[model samples]
Structure formats: C-alpha cells, structure tokens
Target chain A: MIEFHLNSRSGLSPYQQLVQQVRHALRLGLLREGDRLPTVKDVARQMAVNPNTVLKAYRELEHDGLVAARPGVGTFVTRTLADDTLAAQGPLRKDLRRWLAKARLAGLDDESIEALFVSTFRSTAGEDVA
Target chain B: MSAVLRARGLGKRYKKRWALQNCDLEVPAGRVVGLVGPNGAGKSTLLKLACGMLTPTAGTIEVCGGRPAAGVEQLAKVGFVAQDTPVYAALSVADHLDFGKRLSPGWDDAEARDRIRRLGLDPKQRAGKLSGGQRAQLALTLGIAKRPELLILDEPVAALDPLARREFMQDLMEAVAEHELSIVLSSHLVSDVERTCDYVIVVVDSQVQVAGDIDDLVAGHYRLTGPRRDMDALPAGQHVITASHTDRQTTLVVRTDTAVHDPSWTVDPLGLEDIVLAYMARPADAVRDTRPALEVVR
Candidate 1:
C-alpha cells in the first residue's frame, strides 16, 4: 500500500497530487509491482477528501498501466518506472553524495551547487549532441 | 448516477421578501456537495425545503425521488442536521441515543454506539454539559446512524474550534465510507468546502450564482492580468465574473471554457475560494445588463 501525503497549498489539485505520489512512489521503488492500493473509499476517508477525487487518481494510474483494478477486489500495482539506469545508479548516488559533501566543505551552498550542476549537465548534454 | 436531491424553479418566500427564488439544482449521488453562501443567501431555506421541513412558495424540491415531508417513507431516505446541531440538552448521551434509535426508522444502534465509543464521549455524560464540538458529533452520529441514503448537514461544525471542526469533518468522511452515504453539507467557509466537497453550489442574494463540479469550475475560471484593456475588446467567449483595474493594468477573473491565448494577458487558474468569491462579489443584480451571455445562461 502507498501512503499519500498531499500538500493542498502546492497549487495542484488533490487528485493530481495523489496521482503524482503514486507515480513518484513507483519511480523511487517505494511501491512495486503486485502491491495493493487502498480502496477509493479508504483513501478518501483517511485524507478527508471527496471520494471522487480518489477515483480520478486511481483512474489515471490505471490508464498509465501502473495499476489494474479487479471487479470485486482492490487496485494492484502492475508496473513500475524503475529501469536499468535507475537500478544501476546506486554507485552514482554514493559518489554524488561524496562530491556534494566536498562542495559544502569548500563553502559552496546548496543553491550554488544546484546551479553548477544544472549548467554543467546542460553543457555536457549539448556537447554530447554536438 | 441518480440524483438524491433535485429541485427545479425552487423558491421560498417570507411575506414579501424572497428567501430563494428560481433556483434549479441537481445533486447526484456519491458526492459530498457543498451548499455555500452568506447568511441571507437562502441556503437554509433550500435545505429546509429538501428536508420537508418547509414548503416552497413558488417551486418544488424533491428528495430521494419523492417530495420532502410528503410521507413516512420519503422522510426515511434523507437525514438532516440543521444549523446549531440541535441535541436534547436535558438528556444524557445514552438517553439521546435511545431516543434516536426509537425515533428514526432503519436506525443502526450498534453503529451509533460504535461511533460514540470511537469519539471517546462518555455515554453517561449529560448532553447539556458536552462541549459544542461533542454535541455536534453526537448530532452527526444520530444522523449517520439513521443510515439514510443522503445526509444533509447545515453548518454542523460552525461553533467548534479549528481542531474540533477538523475532527468532526473527519468523522463525517468516515461515516460516508462506512455507510456508503451521499452528503449535502452547507457551510459559509470556503476553505472547508474546498477541502471536502467535490461539487459546489454558490448562492448569492437569493439566487444560485453558480453550480458545477469544482474541478470544472476551477478549470473554467481564471485571473487574467495584463495592460489595461477595454472590456469591449475582449472576445465574446470570455465572460467576466469580476474585474479590477489599476492605473496601468487590469486584473479580470473571467469564466470561460475556451483556451485563453491572448498574448498580452497572463492567464492564471483561480482557486476554488477565488472562484466562489468572484461570483459572490458580483451578484447578478449588480451586473444584470452588463453581459447578455451571463444573463442568458442564468
């Protein structure tokens, strides 16, 4: 089961937030194939939202082939976005963390590190294309 | 889906003053519809009519496919908790539960007791001594225990503190799930309505200013900010709900399904609160002749 945390103040609709959470969970491996999702009624009651909102989110998930709903049973995850690149990124993540620690030690703040990463990445991608 | 509550040309009058007039509404099942308006916007009048508590002066209201207050079976299909969440102050909580079980047909005694226990309210406590929030919870329990197809709540949490209000709403959603019931909850708070309601009915000055699914309503309304431009210059599809202007620029909240592609304006989607308040701020009487399209639709 996936736990949905919605920020109503985030300017996105509640259903959209729910849909995104499911997708994010799937992408991050928090949710995987064969995991059951809570019924629309349960999610609505727990979140104190209109039930139709949950239905909409579930419908979007089903449309994306991330979930499948049985007639008498609940929705189940059928697919996930985790692929080979994501699965092989463990060492890359560890190295990036070490680099980030070094950058912070060198007095580069998070904003500067993020800016440097974006510009560097964009340039590298452009060079690859060129 | 079948509508649990339907009204056409629904009107109610007191002496010469019209409380509500020419209102047409259809509330489909499986929705928590919010009836929102100001104190004098005829929200209570409409609810009372649907509950069969008051007769209409000019129109008709039907609840559960039958006229309200029409007969015994008709009254059993819908439950109503009016403003102030009236409970027998003299009775103990246990006594109130007993009374509810005896009075309401299709009463679920175990469900009521379970809810009471979950709320952690003492059964021996006197209703008069319970806090406003507790009393409201008790009232809701009675209404939900009746197990009606549709439950009508009129500002059921207005008197509670913020925490109590939230808890009471939480109870409502739980009851909705446990019983598979549709609800029509009325409130003056836009935030509460936006949080819990899928459908909205905005009443302004004895008229329904707007009634639609909140998703559609929000998608249609927008705040367009741009350099000052004449209203006549805008396209016909853009029906302005409210407009404010400055020396250099104009901000208009308009309701339109058409895609806004105007290069000069920055179109921003309005939130539910903004959309509701926009219609409320500009009553039909205030802008009757200004827009023929709005009038015609109304």
Candidate 2:
C-alpha cells in the first residue's frame, strides 16, 4: 500500500532506495508491525524493476530485523526494536555527531541557530514568508 | 557447480544458410548466466535447441546430464520462459496455477501462494486483463514455481519499461537464490545483464562467439590500441576476436588466459558488451577458415 517512486539517477542503488523508503515509513509509523509487504515480484511489476532488485532490498530489510519472511507465508514487518538496539546503532550516531559538529563550526551563535531552526520549521508549516 | 547443460559441436541450418555453426558450451549449475546478441544472431534459436523445442541440424545437446530432445525427464527438469511471455490470456491467474499443478510433477503450491499474496495479485484476475508488466510477472511465476533445476528465460523483460525491467530482474535473482536453480537467460540489454548475471555467452553470426564467467572474460580479454603490426607475429596464446585498423593504428580485441605486456600495443580491459559487439559485428564468412574443433566426446 506504500507508494513511492525510485529515482533512476539517484546516487543510491535501487535496493538502498527501497530500504530507505521503508525505513522512512517505519519512522513515520505509517507501517505497523505485522504489516505485510508486497511480494518481490509484485513490487517489481508495480515499479517496473527487476525482481532481483526487490529481493535485494527485502534481503537487506530482513537482515536489519525490520522485516521477516515465513517460508509458506509472505514477508511482514517485525515488531519494534528492543531498547538495547540503540547500543548497536553505531553508524547512525556517528553520522548525527558529524552533522552536528559541522553545524556548530559554521559560526552561527546559539540564538541564531535556534532562530534558524524555528524559521525552517515555520516554512514547512505553511508560512508564506520566505 | 556441476555441468548442468552441455552443447557439443551444435550447429543449425536454414534452407540455404547456416544459422549457428559448430557451437560448443558447457554451463555449470546454480548460476545465473546470460546470452547476449543482436537480432538474427541466432540467440533465440540457441535457446530453443537447449530447451529441445527445435532439433539441431548438426552436433548434439544435453540438458541436466541427459539428452533433452529424447525424453521428457530432461525437459521437465528444465523450465523455459520463451521470448514472449506465453500465457493463456483467457484463463484466470488461479486457473493458471491450477493447470500447472495438474501438469507439473514438482509444483510447489506453498511457494506459489506466498508469491501471489506478496504481489497482491488476485487469483481471479484474468491474464488478458493484466498489464504488460503483470503478464510478465505471471509468466515468471508459472515458470519459476514449477521448481525446475534449470530455468531458461528468453528476453523476459525486453518489453517492459526501464523500472519494470529492473524489478523483474530483482525478482528473478531472488527466485534463483531461493530455489538454488541454474538460470540461462538471453537478452540484448547490456546494463540488465551486467546487474543480474554472473556468466555470459556472446552469440554472433549464428555462432557462440564467446562463453565464460563474466569476471574471467572481462579480466582475460584486452583491447589494444596502438601502431599496426602483423597479428601473425602475436604469441600463440593470444587469439584475436576482432581487429579494426585506422590510418596509423590498429585496435584489436584479443582473448588470452595470460597477460600481454607487449610495448607495441596498449592493452586495456574489455567490457562484456564491447566483447559481444566485437563478435556480432563480424561478417558471417569472415572466420570460416578457423573451423571449430569437433572432437566432442558427449
């Protein structure tokens, strides 16, 4: 039921793109635990991709514990990760730390940074001002 | 990886012409192999012969260690998805499965149902009402769910859109992995082959121009661009697949198991598509003098 277009020109491989989209959906709570996924063939048909590409994405998701496949049944979203899961989120925390350090080094004061953050939020909230 | 399919001294002829001449190939099992060529290069005919749909005019072919044309056991172990996605248009998706269940001895109903549900396809949907992409999926479902040891797909994604094509290949790769099946598919799309296949067979001028694992083929073949020299003087191990000459230089694609470090030519790696085109571009009679070795024991 999730609808998203894969950008052919994107730097990410097709499998990575699918994994990102699915992760994004999970973050937004759009996809709940026990939610069924389209068959690899079905997604390929809908997106006009080779089934192998979808399989790759599904395999990644399965490896990440976000999805699980039943031999006689279809794949479904797994339940939420354990609290200790964050202990294993090494790459994500490293990326966040790097981005924050870069933002701090950009020479903006704390007040200016907060102001910039508020304005950025307002723009996405339907504000007319640029 | 055992030799699942073998073709020795295989040749085919039309009324007054030879389509494929003295072709020899041995394909290992549980690997994804690609057959590439231009139109009228006899790629489809080669697949037909492998599937036992057409009789070879000369030489012999064996599928899964047995003669394909002689019996149904070998043919049954081999599942063929032809150039066109041939399915019963009037039948429903469920009916197609039912027919497969009735006809195929090794049909896996659980796998078929799981795949169908994952794709969100209704069993009652008629094949004729399905879209082009859907028809292709259905054809694959039928062919793959039969649990054949060797799956031969002929241009299964050629008619699909770019996105659809990628998805179809992804699905195919997953199936190959899950079933542990050997696949030999034919296509003109190089990019698709690059992504999905590990082995390659180049068909040109009605013959198997070259066949090997892709990594080995690419690593072994070299494109040398430099001043012209007598190719007869080249070492015995270096076999020239194609040679093009300009005013002051000669560009040649050569196959050698050993590395060539000659100072006269700059040797560069060759792409699968480049090697395939080199063979397809050759004239039909150009290499007639180099007769194929015909000491096929099988």
Candidate 3:
C-alpha cells in the first residue's frame, strides 16, 4: 500500500501535489517500473480527496509516460525521468557536495548558500533540474 | 453529462424578507459541490429548495432533470441530511438502519450494516446514547445506503471534533467513490470544503456570488496589491470582487484570467479559502459593478 500524504495548506492543488509526490518518489528510487500505485478509491478514502482528483493525477502521470492502467488491474509506474540524466547527475552531486563543504569551511551559512542557489537556479532554464 | 441539480431564478421569501433571491445556479453531475457562505447567506434556503422541502416563491429547482419532489420517483432521486444530522434519538443503531431500509426503496441493507460495523457502532445501542460524531456517522450511513442519485448534506461535520471531522469527510469521499451519486454539501467552514469538494458555490447575502469548478475558480481569481491608485484605472477585464485600501496602498481581489501586464501591481494566485472569503466579504450594498456573472459551465 502506498503511504500517501497530502498537505492541505500547501499552495499546490491536491492533484498537482499527488503528481509531484509520485515524481519525487520516482526520482528518489522509492518507486520504479512495475510498481503498482495505490488504487484511486483507496487514496481518495485515505487522503479525504475526491476520487476524480486522484484519477486526474493518474491521468496526468499517464500523459507524462510515467504510469499506465490495465483494464482489470491497478495502475503501475511505467517509467521515471530519463535514467541517463539521473546517471549523469551522480557526479554533479559529488562535485556539489565537495563545493558545499568548502563553502561551509569558508564561513558560508546555509541560508546564504540557499539564497545563492535559488538565484542561480532561477536565472537559468530549469529544465531537467529536478 | 446533464446537470444533477439546476435552479433558475429561484427565491424563497419569509414575509417581507427573501431567504434566497434570483439564485440561478446549476450543479454538475457526479461531483462533490460545496455551498459556502456566512450565516444568513441563504445557503440553507438554497439547499432546502433543492431537496423540495420548501416551495420556491419565484422560480424552479430541478433534481436529476425533473422537478424537485414532484413524486415518488423525484423524491427517490435526492437524499437529504440536514444541518443537525438528524436521526431518531429513540431508535437503536440497528433499528435506525432497519428503518432506513424499510423507508427507502433503494436502501442497501448490507452496506448500511457494514458501515455501522466499520465505525465500531453497537447495533443495539440507542441513537440517544451515541456521541454527536457517532450519530452523524449513523445519519451518513443511512444517507449513503439510501442510494439516492444525489445527496445534499448541510454542515454534517460542524459539531464533530477535528479527528472525527476528518474521519467523517474521509467516509464521505469513500462513499462518493463507491456510489453513483452526486453530492451538494453546504458548509461555512471553507477548510472542510477545500479538502472535500471538487466544485464550489459561494452564496452571499441571499444570492449566488459565484459557482464553478474549484480548480478553475482558484486559477481565475487573484490578489493584486500596488501603490495607492484609483480603482477606475484598472483594465476593463480586471473586475474587482472586493477591495481593501490603506492610505499608501490598495489590495484588490479580482476575478479574471487575463495576464497582468502592469509591473506596478503584484499579482498573486489565491487559495480556495482566500477566494471564498473575498466573495463573502464583498459589501452587499455596493453596486457590484456590472461585471459579468461567473459562467456556470455545466
């Protein structure tokens, strides 16, 4: 069973939040191909959202080529964000980790580093960054 | 799909006062539509009319494409749970379920029994002894098992504690998923509606302020804050729903999908509650600037 959760206070709509959660889980290796997503009825009951809202999330996921539904069975995670890009991101993560340690040693606090990261991230095209 | 509930020029007057006036609205089928507004906003009046409890003084209301409460067929198409979540206090839990089965031609006996069991309700316990939340559960079970094509609930969870409220709404969502029923739930608590309903109807001062799909409504409304300026300068498309002003600045909540081109105004997307509160806060006496009514795209 999917341990799904939603933050009603978040600015994002419920369906959009569910989509992002599935995407995040895929990226973090928490879910993968052939993994069955929780049924719409279960998520709606557990999360207290309309079943159509959950269906909308599943539809969007299918449109993005991340999931699919079988006639008699439940929806399944069909794929994740490009595996090649994820592989490519590994070394960049290592480099960023080392640079973050240096920045900390040079007295750069987390807030300042975060502010710098946000500004840089915002100025460039955000595609494939997540 | 055809509208499940449609009302045109609907009104109900009490002596000289109109409880609801010129309330033209349509609720789409198979959606959980919420009716929201402050007390005395005619939310109850509109719901009562939909259920055919009160005759409309001005116009008409139809449920499932037929006149509300016209006959046994019409009556069977709509179910109602009023503000108090009324259940016979003297009846035992099992007796209440049994009564519902006998009274409603379409009642699902097994489902009603299963709901009671799942709620951990004692079948032999009298309704008078059940807690407020428990009674509400029993009422909702009856409402759902009655299996009307549409269910109208008036503030069913208002008396429940936080956890109980969550459980109640969860059960409602589950019921909606399982049954082929449309729900029109009325609530003053925007938070409850925000979590439970997909469509929204905002009533204010005995009139329909706005009604539409929740996601579309939220996307179209925005708060624009900027330096002190006259309202007349805003573009014709930017219709103000409500405005608050200070000496140095003005913050106007407007309903429009047009992109804001002016750099001076900071435009922010509104959450459901913010948009609802803005509509409820509108001064009823104002001329309401002849902006077009929200198109009920049913």
Candidate 4:
C-alpha cells in the first residue's frame, strides 16, 4: 500500500500528494511492479480524502502506465519502467543528496557524514541488506 | 466496492431523549459524504457509532462492512478525527507526530515529516502554544497520516476563523483529490458541506431526513413558490417533501426528476443550505392528506 498523508496547511493538493507518494515509492523500489494497492475506498478512508480524489489520482497513474487496473480484481504497479531508469532517477539518489545537504549544513566532518549515512541507510534497508 | 460503513435501524439514546432513530444507511466507496444537522441532532452519535467509539443501543452498526466495535480488525481501516481537534498541550508538534508514528501501525512517518515541513509548522514548538488553526492542521495531519480506509472528521475546523476555515477546507479538498480518500465529515455549517461534499446526509432530530447525491437531490427536488394552488392540481409522480404558506402564496419543495413539462407555479432552484433547512424545519405532521399548494417550475 502507498501510505498517504495530507496537510491542511500545505500548498499541495491531496491528489498530488497521493500521486507523488505512489510514484516516489515505485522509484524507491519500496513498492514493486505488481504490488497491489489498497482499494480506492481504502486509500480514501486512510487519507481522509474523497474517493473521487483517489480515483482521479489512480486514473492519472493508469494514464502514465505506472499502474494497471484489473477489472474485478484490483490496481497494481506495472513493470513498465526499466530497472536501470528506476535505479537512477528515483528517490535513492535524491535521498542521498538530501542527507548530504543536511550533514553539510550541520557542519559535520566528511567521515562523520559518511558513517552516519551508511548506518542510517543500512538500518532503513535492513540488517541483512547491509 | 464494499460499503465502508453500514447502519441499519441504528439509534442512540441519551437518558429520556432519542438522539437518532430508525437510521439505515450504507456508505459506498469513493465519495466525500457530509453529515449535517442542527445541534443535538445525533450527528455526533452517528459518527461515533460508525467509528466504533460508541455502541448503538437499538440496531446494527458496521465499519468497513463489519461490526463497528472495539478490536474489530476493520477498525484499522477507519481513521477518526474527533471534534475540536484535541492535542496534548504540552507536547511539541514533533512529539505529537512521534506519538502518531508509535500508535498507528500504518503510520507513514516520512509522509508526516514531509507534510510538517511542507506546512512550515515548527515541529519542535510546543503544541499547546500553537494557534487554533495550527492545532486543527496538526490534528488533520495525524488523521491523514494514519492511512486508514475511511476518515471521519467531527467538526474538524469548527474552531477556526473564516480565513482559517477556508484554508482548512481547501487543504482538505486538495488532500481528498490527491488521496481519493472517502471522507465523512460532520458540521452544522451547510456552506462548508456544500463546497466540500458531493453527497450529503441530513440528520434531523436524531433521524436521517435525507441522504443522496447533491446533484440528484437538487435536480430531483424543486422549490415551487407562487399563488396558492391546490396540491391535487399538481401533476402526478411528484412527491412533496416540504411545504410552507404565507397568506396567498404556498411554497413547496417536491422531487420530480422526470421533468415538469408544465406547472401551476414558478419553480426555483434551491441552494444546498436552503434544501437542508427546509428538511430540518419539516413538521412532524407535514405529511398530510391535503396536497400542498403546488407551484409549477417556470
């Protein structure tokens, strides 16, 4: 499932949030192609949004070929994007840069930043992955 | 799609008073439905029952198509933000987020953090010190971050100023559009409901007055205001839901989707609030043998 949230104080729309999160998750390899998302109702309920809103987002996703809907079954991620592209332009590189920016702003030494990033990355990725 | 919430003859009682009665409703998937009524109309009771926070005394209640009670696995699918957007006064905005992360198994911490950043809320600032609007925003954030299947908000922005209310509603609508979440929000303000919901359920005196698509209700229902005309003269297939009189003029609200090719009095379009108040003011004995003076839609 693509876990979602909405900020009543943010400039972004709820549909945008849903779209971004689902795509971000796909790019991060957190949600693989063929991963079935919660039903539109399910997403709506969880996110405090209208089902129409979620439907619009899903429709957009389907249009983008990022998700495939099976009649009477459910919506799932489709293996349309190449792994190489998924490995490159998604969240991984962006997340790394984000961590780097934070570390640099905190005035951390290069070695300290590297150690922190490696530890945090390992923890997030799982002990076995490390 | 499965019904996210179901109520059959579900009712609530408060001492000698009946808050809601003979209520039967099925909330289908993928809609932002609004619950509206006057104070003490049992709107809160209905929401509480749907959230499984209150047990019904008279009939069945279900959330996510199962019993709406404590420990029902389906409870995990419903996210409820109660009235007043309560939060710990002493906790920081960040602390509240941490609490949500710990308590809600489906909590999306990253999303919550990102939202906080996007909203420009000082996560480290004490929640008690935040303004009412900020508090409501935080409550909304927590509710949305849980990722439940149904989110029920009880007067979520009732405390804010007009600007704040508009912002809150806009934000909510945006989120609804983004997440496609089905929301059941309760409010006494029909204006808010009118702007935010496509579907509406009017709870009056602890009873469901009417529930349906706003467009259907509007297009199906008409306001006839004109010279006093006998109801019997009105065309067949029209059912009057409410009627009023002022000397020579009789105003009636009737539902006729087939179209009134010709009518006795001029028909008028009813705004959402007008229709709601019409039903809210419906007299117990309003349904009478005499046809209300019918006015033709011009």
TM-score per model (chain B): 0.94, 0.92, 0.96, 0.91
TM-score of chain B of 2: 0.92
Over the stretch A41-99, how does candidate 2's per-residue lDDT look in tens digits?
Answer: 56754554445557778888999999999975788999544334555678888986786
Query: Which pairs clash (backbone N, Cα, C closer than 3 Å) in model 3?
Result: none
lDDT of 2 by residue, B69-118 (tens): 56656656989898878889899999999998887788998888888887
Off by over 4 Å in 2: A1-130, B285-298
Q: What is the Å distance of residue B11 in model 2 from its true position? A: 2.2
**If both were scored by TM-score, which would come out higher, candidate 2 or candidate 4?**
2
**Per-prediction count of colliding residue pairs?**
0, 23, 0, 20
Which model is ahead, 2 or 3, in terms of DockQ?
3
* Interface RMSD, one decimal, each candidate: 4.7, 9.2, 3.4, 13.3
- In order of TM-score, best first, we have 3, 1, 2, 4
lDDT of 4 by residue, A50-117 (tens): 56757777888999989989987999998544476855766888987897888899999999988876
**Candidate 4 chain A lDDT trough over 10 residues, lowest sum:** A121-130
- Give one digit per residue, the lDDT tens place, for model 4 in B1-298: 5777778889888788888887877767767889998888889999998888778889898777677656646766788889999999999999999998888878888878887897789989999998998888899899888887788999988888997777677667666756757789999887667556767888877877778776566666768888886778777777777877878999888777555545456655566777788878887445232123221221
Model 3: CA > 4 A from native: A82-130, B285-293, B296-298
The local lDDT score (0 to 100) that residue B143 gets in candidate 3 is 91
Q: What is the overall TM-score of model 1 with all chains considered together?
A: 0.85
Top model by lDDT, which number? 3
Candidate 1, residues B6-33: lDDT per residue as tens digits? 8888899999999998888777788889
How do the candidates rank by DockQ, highest first?
A: 3, 1, 2, 4
lDDT of 3 at A87: 88
